[model samples]
Target: MPRYEYRCRTCGDTFELSRPMAQSSAPAACPDGHEDTVKLLSAVAVGGTASAAPAGSGGGCCGGGCCG
Candidate 1:
């Protein structure tokens, strides 16, 4: 299951729900009893251990040096 963020248009309340991907865009009701909720676009972050780059090798494009 994937967690989805929803925002209620009527009450301006936001909430999260874990459901199947097939229902990602399905209609959802807000906790405040508002049915005019819409799914909000959210970012997903993937994390990993940072490793040092080899000598003379170009680091990450951002130049943060987190080139693993």
Candidate 2:
């Protein structure tokens, strides 16, 4: 299973859910029972070593970024 981030457009709430990849884009109601929620196009932290960079800092070096 993969974790996904979603934002509820109706109630302006953000939440996460773990589901199969096939359900990544499925229409899902917010946990708060709001139906006008939509999946947010957000970056998921997959397998990798964690870093201490500040939030929004590019993760590559050598003129690219840190993560590169």
- The best candidate in terms of lDDT: 1
Q: Tell me the spans in candidate 2 whose CA falls farther than 4 Å from its real position.
A: 44-68
lDDT of 2 at 20: 96
Q: Output the number of the TM-score-best candidate.
A: 1
Worst 10 residues of 1 by lDDT: 56-65
TM accuracy, model 2: 0.61
Model 1: lDDT equals 0.87
Q: Candidate 2, 43: how far from true, in Å?
A: 2.0
- Per-candidate Cα lDDT values, in order, are 0.87, 0.81
- Candidate 2, residues 1-68, lDDT tens digits: the string is 78888899988989999999988999888988988988888865877547655556555464345544
Across 35-54, the per-residue lDDT of candidate 1 in tens digits comes to 99889999889876478565
Candidate 2 CA-lDDT value? 0.81
